[model samples]
Target: MTRYEFVARAHAEGYSPPKEVTFAPSTRSEPHTHDQLSFVYVVAGTFILNTDRAAPAYQPGETCLLDANVAHAEEAGPQGATILVARKSGRVAETG
Candidate 1:
């Protein structure tokens, strides 16, 4: 199995304001919400993502978006998943 590595960045490849957060194998996020409009691009591997509104399966190059105040969670595969997350920073805004 290949080891997974997560690279967290506030901005990547011209991804400004909202940045891309890369994740590794079996990476997870606590049930949380974001203030600004945010989303993710699955760079590699498979992952499961759950939110108040949906639970989606993501593959490489998949995209996800959520509004503020919405509870969300995630877990990647055994080999881990790579996620590029983009969101707003500073204040908590919006609601579930």
Candidate 2:
């Protein structure tokens, strides 16, 4: 979806305003978790989102949603990536 659509959807879903984040070329992040529901929209280059079940590549105008506290990691494509992220704060129930 386009950035406009992404932001509109995110806001409708209760996410806070988005903030831009830039990842360096070939960069990778250690597995991590966020306390809030996360929404990410790729603005430039590529973003590889890694989860236990899959790793999907996101191009410009693409977006991804991650549930609160879900374990995941990120990798930046060779040319690097810029993304907009919005989050919704809330407690997520623990699952077995």
- The candidate that achieves the highest TM-score relative to the unseen native structure: 2
Give lDDT per model, in order.
0.62, 0.90
lDDT by residue (1-96, candidate 1, tens digit) is: 111221233354222344344556767888886665555667777878888767888887556656656778887877777766656543234355
- Assess candidate 1 and give its lDDT: 0.62
For model 1 the local lDDT of residue 81 reads 77
lDDT of 2 at 52: 94
Candidate 1: clashing pairs of residues: 21-85, 25-80, 26-80
Q: For candidate 2, which ten residues in a row score worst on lDDT? A: 87-96
TM-score of each: 0.61, 0.87
After TM-score superposition, what is the CA distance of residue 5 in candidate 2 from its true location, in Å? 2.0
Q: lDDT per residue, candidate 2, 1-96, as tens digits?
A: 888998898889788999999999999999999999888999999999999999999999988888888899989999999999999876434355
Which segments of candidate 2 are over 4 A away from where they belong?
Answer: 90-96
